[model samples]
Target: MDEDTTLLALSAIAHRSRLAIFRLLVAVGPRGLPAKEISAQLGIVPSSLSFHLKDMSRANLVSRSREGTFIYYSAALDAIHGAIDFLTENCLAGAAGNPSSR
Candidate 1:
């Protein structure tokens, strides 16, 4: 991921609610969860949840699908992996004398 994309993804989860939502979505796996359930679990209002979901969507952190009248949200693993790769690009653990290497 580029710096701009990385920044957006990082900012999307930089809030209390957003972080919780992301974690919940990941926990539930790609099957995802509906908006109402997410709100109930996180104790966030519908309006706020909607806002956070939109932000995550824009950042490619979460994906939404309409199943019947409810919208299901799932964590976007590709984006998450990209963010992790970008953040750890400079950390070469296998390099000789690397402190991070076991």
Candidate 2:
């Protein structure tokens, strides 16, 4: 992932509610959860959850699909993984004397 994408994903989950939502979705895996289920599980009101979901979707951190009348939201695993890899690329490479060796 590029810097912009990484920043976007990071910013999206920076809020407490958004972070919680993302974690919940990630825990549920690709099967996802319907909006009502997510709100109930997180104790978030429908309007608040809707707002957060919109921000997450805009950041490409989450995606949604319609199943009948329900909208299921899932974490964008690939985007999340890409951001993590980008942020940690070559992590600890320049550490003094290699902590692992100690």
lDDT of each: 0.91, 0.91
TM-score of each candidate structure, all chains considered together = 0.87, 0.87
The sequence of per-residue lDDT tens digits that candidate 2 reaches over residues 47-98 is 9999999999999999999999999999998888888887667453445567
Off by over 4 Å in 2: 90-102
C-alpha root-mean-square deviation, candidate 2: 3.0
Backbone clash total for model 2 is 0
Q: Candidate 2: global Cα-lDDT?
A: 0.91
